[model samples]
Target: MVSTPLPPADEKAVWVRSMFDRIAPRYDRFNDLLSAGVHRRWRARTIDALAPTGGETFLDLCAGTMDLAVAISERAPGARVAAADFSIRMLASGREKAAATPGPVHPVAADALALPFPDAAFDGCTIGFGLRNLADYSQGLAEMQRVLAPGGRLVVLEFTTPPGKVFRALYHGYFHHVLPRAGALVSHDSAAARYLPESVKAFPDVRSLARLLREAGFDRVRYRYLTGGIAALHHGVRP
Candidate 1:
């Protein structure tokens, strides 16, 4: 299936940025339809995992419309949160919603592979459902490590296939079939909907991702399956 290219490389960046720009208007609705409102719950769970304490600074990489950034703001009303993404339209969409949260939620246009901020600039890092689309997950992880202060925590929430054969079969069917159709109907962007599952299907497993995190200079790397292994959350601390 033909779909939007991945990011960082010039062509892929252009394709991804354009795709997200087109979908920015429908993204929230698209997500609601794609996950049947469960994505919100998953995001809420991710914020809990992020464990934002008031007054701390956090960065949301690949922030995509700022769902998690808003969650972080609401959860820790005094925290300063920066939501970074390469898609200008997506960042604009997020900026429109920033007023709802008590704390500051700044939408910054930045790529994950080469973040624009200084080293050790944030107290925590959070990325949700966005890691798979990075040009190189390892480089992205390293960038995350670079921006986080020593002992800063990084939390990642992403879709993953189930391990059990029977469950994997059912999950693959939904990912390849039902989800894309639902996504297309909501976003009216069939190529992106098709790319969603295809990209995630090609991504590294949760265990491999944990190793990559460790190799990228993060300590205490660990992961846990969510939603019967349909998604996973990985957490680590900067060394």
Candidate 2:
């Protein structure tokens, strides 16, 4: 299969939105196959790190399918969740689940780099498997920090390069080879399938991502690898 080229710098956001729009119908299904349903555990870890409280506002940025947002609402029954993402189709795919949540989970079509919400608007924010798609990771982190209230936490659940060399090699082989083919077959969008591994390869590893979180003006930044380092959950507090 021909590899899908990463989007040009000037068009990254637009390209990402379009790509996700095409795959929104199968996004959740493909995610289950790719991670073997392990993404749910990773998202559970994100909620644990955030330890959200009742009556607080949360922003599930890049909240494709509203999985994390719905979970957060379930956890904090009195909280409000803004399921924000640039791809409207992606958001639409999960509207029913979001609506069924005991707490409110409002779908908001917005870009990650430039959020429409006011500063310090959220008590917590979470992004699951979505940050690396951004045109600028730094700007994304900064924007996350900007919308969070002081002392509010940001939890990021993302694919990361593993630390152990042997495991890393095996992980890469599957990610670069097996995942793309399976993704293509299931999603019927080969370019989007190929883009997954390519994007994860270009994304920062656990430590580097932690550093970026710190540099983004977040305090108490820390990360924990999950499932043999196939993915990671990083959390930080806005000061």
Candidate 3:
């Protein structure tokens, strides 16, 4: 499979936000179709990694549509889950979804790099499928570490390039070609789907990501690759 080059730095975030806004209506549906419903399981695993206790203040960064936030609320009923996103449209959709759920999630519009919160404000944080879009992913990771209290856990779930030679070839083909086409057909935004593959290719992988987390002042940094390395859940502590 031919690798598609990453988009330039200046245009990447703008393109990603625009694409997400365009696909916001069908976002959940597209995710279900794209990942064959496995994203739900991945989210469950991510929430499990965080292991939120009741009554803790949890922050879900880049909480696109609040999937992770809702999952956290369900898993830890007494926990207060706050969802933050830079895109107003995405936050609006997430708020609407949260309104229907049993547990209430506070939705806030905020940037990932410069989170609007006091230091060490949250007990735990989770970000799913949203880190790749940040202009400075390292800075975003640092902000996540900053907002967490001492010993607070940070969980990040993201797509990654598969490792096996044959499977990697097949995955790349599907990611770059088939996914874009199907996503365009379903969401009516080809650029958004195209951006997905590009962003994954550009984002740091598990090993490098763990290093970045440590650099951002996190300790006990570790990651588990899921689905044969096509995705990963990275964890760290704010020590």
Judging by lDDT against the true structure, name the best candidate. 2
Q: How well is each residue in 75-108 modelled by candidate 2, as lDDT tens digits?
A: 9999999999999999999988988999989999
Candidate 3 or 2, higher TM-score = 2
Distance (Å) between predicted and true CA of 74, model 2?
Answer: 0.9
Candidate 1: pairs in clash: none
Off by over 4 Å in 3: 1-7
Q: Per-residue CA lDDT of candidate 3, range 54-118, in tens?
A: 88999999998999998989888888989998777887776766886656689988888899999
Assess each prediction's global lDDT (C-alpha) against the native. 0.87, 0.92, 0.87
Pick out the ten consecutive residues of candidate 1 with the lowest summed lDDT: 1-10
Candidate 1 residue-wise lDDT at 133: 75
Better of 1 and 3 by TM-score: 3
lDDT of 3 at 126: 98
Judging by lDDT, tell me the better candidate of 1 and 2.
2
lDDT of 1 at 134: 77
**Stretches of model 1 off by over 4 angstroms after superposition:** 1-10
- Model 1 residue 167 lDDT? 90
